[model samples]
Target: MIRALVLALCGLATAATAQDTAEAALRAVQQLEAASISLQEAGSGRDRISALTETVQAYEAGMAAMRDGLRRAAIRERTLTRDLNTQSDEVAQLLGVLQRMGQAPTPLLLLHPSGPTGTARSGMMLADVTPGLQAKVDVLRAQLEEVAILRQLQGDALATLEQGLAGAQEARTALSEAVSDRTDLPRRFSDDPVKTALLLASTETLAAFASSLAEIEAETGAPPAPDATALKGQLALPVDGTVLRGFGDADAAGIERPGIVIATAPRALVTAPAAATIRYSGPLLDYGNVLILEPAQDVLWVLAGLAQVFGEIGQVLPEGAPVGLMGGDLSDAQAILTESRQGAASTRPESLYLEVRDGQGAVDPATWFAYD
Candidate 1:
């Protein structure tokens, strides 16, 4: 029964190890490489932008998987090492007993102090003990092998990390250039510079500025607004992240804003949640690199806190189009690996603020975005 229990524990450990996260990371790397190839073969303008976008996203996913795999490997290694240390004395005693039994002559091993009956009992006891001893040995061997593998995995991951980081940086550069060169998107209307400047100079709050957006537009035969009512409660968040603060939530400063704040990784890709026309795309009062989109008449989606913004004001953007990137410096391979080994959370220090407005009133973004 003891042997059976030990074997069961070993089997469970083996099964858990079989779900290799390192392999998942490798698959992500392959995807990143494929995306890089696609970007190289892409045509100019939107085609290149789309391909570059895919490349960047792939690299991001690959890096995340790699980091997770490394962290798990480090944890597993520590656990196995600790277990081995705890069992060292017992293992040594078991080995000594086995060695003595093996060295004894057959007649001497079979002999007992109480003669025949004692010898028969001793034989039965040895039979039971042998299997349990073997089970422990097997468990120890398996653990050692896993520790070695985990170490190798961590060591080999550095190269993969470097590749992913380089690929992501290159993709980001290409995406920036492609967006800058793009000029084919349809325009809704040109923004009046003087009116925008005057509004920015006088506007005291985001709500007030949003309410007066129509006053600064220089109309140039704009198309009919698309109906986005069907997309309500179905729109994806503009960026991949966790919501740090919900709409109307008070901060440490006791200030409540009618927007949801999202925490995201450095340079994370930001995209449009729905097909929309860009009403404004630039610096706002206190928000950094704000982008306001009109998905439907009298409705606006505002995204802020970006390091860079894409597309010009008054241009129509399809759903999922690249909008901007979150702000922060990308960590190098060594730094990322060290952090992963230490089991720290991936640096998601950048924040994106999102606000939804219907007519003249701000509403909770959770009502529209499917964050859950």
Candidate 2:
């Protein structure tokens, strides 16, 4: 999932850059005629006006054509991410069926199967309780192949987007140079303030668009989550950071105890202490990017930091798959993660958050992890 998401984001970032380029080109086109007229009235050279006008018109047309394609690229990225997630889920179910038939995970150790027969043989016996389990597994294998194809498609689209962005940037550079060459024009427009403001606005607009896309992705449902029991003691600390608050820690005066706080820098990668499904993924009041992982019915874990998220909710994560990147941007607030509480105070921190919950209660993570 992390690889898929990273690819998706790379695509999105490329698209966003392309979109900005397109927008800038369009803006230049709109500004061209007025600028030309003004330059004419200001007694600018005919060649200067003509050059500016032509540049603007050309950029407008070029970027206009690229806009739809850029948007499509973004959409394609989103689609592939969503599809891969779904396929992974379907494949997992099929694997389950194979496991029941006593033929699951057939030696990927020897040779990776690329065709149907190898897949069928994998879950031949100890099959699932459900009918058509073998067929379903075959279908899943096929779908996995399809996922690979979609990934290639996504990569191609991203390349195209990158090309377009490069072209648009080149065009902008040309335009800026042209603008600079016309020295007789108003000097004020060439000042730092206007350019800075314009640049900021453009960048902010791009950031907002990216955030919107992320929100949309978040709204989408993910594949089947991992069982809490599956994660119990499967994960271990990856770094050393302090836990400012304990699981269910509250002062006698009623101050709430943080689930787990592992102090780390921005962009530190958070991983699952054990294999599990993400229970929560979002920024809570103060915890910048918080992830809750449940290791079992009586166990829950929380991870928080100031940074980008590495996984989505409901994602079945492995023991060390990046869960989130840590950041230190939010001051006076601590990021955290933990397992189900068994009721005790925790004293260990590796910049990784740990907590335990037993019967919906807080347990000291230190002893359980040490004992485990």
Leading candidate by lDDT = 1
Expressed as tens digits, the lDDT of each residue in 1-372 for candidate 2 is 112222333443344444554454445444544545554565444355344434334433433333333344435445556676877876677667557547545465234366666566545533453456657666656655654544454445444434434443454444445434543321111124453344434543322322222222222243333454533454455333455556566645776653454554332334556666554556544445556665544355655453555444445555544454444432110111011011112223224445455544556665345332
lDDT of 1 by residue, 1-372 (tens): 112222222332343363455455455556656666776787757767877777777667656655665666677788888999998999899889989988999999998999999999999999999999999889989999888877766666666667667767877887898888898788787757886788889989899989988555536577666567798998889887899999899977999999999998999999888888898889998998999999988889999999999988888887777999888999987898799778676778999999999988999997889985
Q: Estimate each model's TM-score.
A: 0.89, 0.30
Those runs of model 2 whose alpha carbons end farther than 4 Å from true positions after fitting are: 1-235, 242-258, 329-354
**Least lDDT summed over 10 consecutive residues: which range in candidate 2?**
332-341
Clashing pairs in 1: none
Question: What is the TM-score (0 to 1) of candidate 2?
Answer: 0.30
Full-model lDDT for every candidate: 0.79, 0.44
Q: Candidate 1: where is the Cα deviation over 4 Å?
A: 1-44, 105-107, 216-220
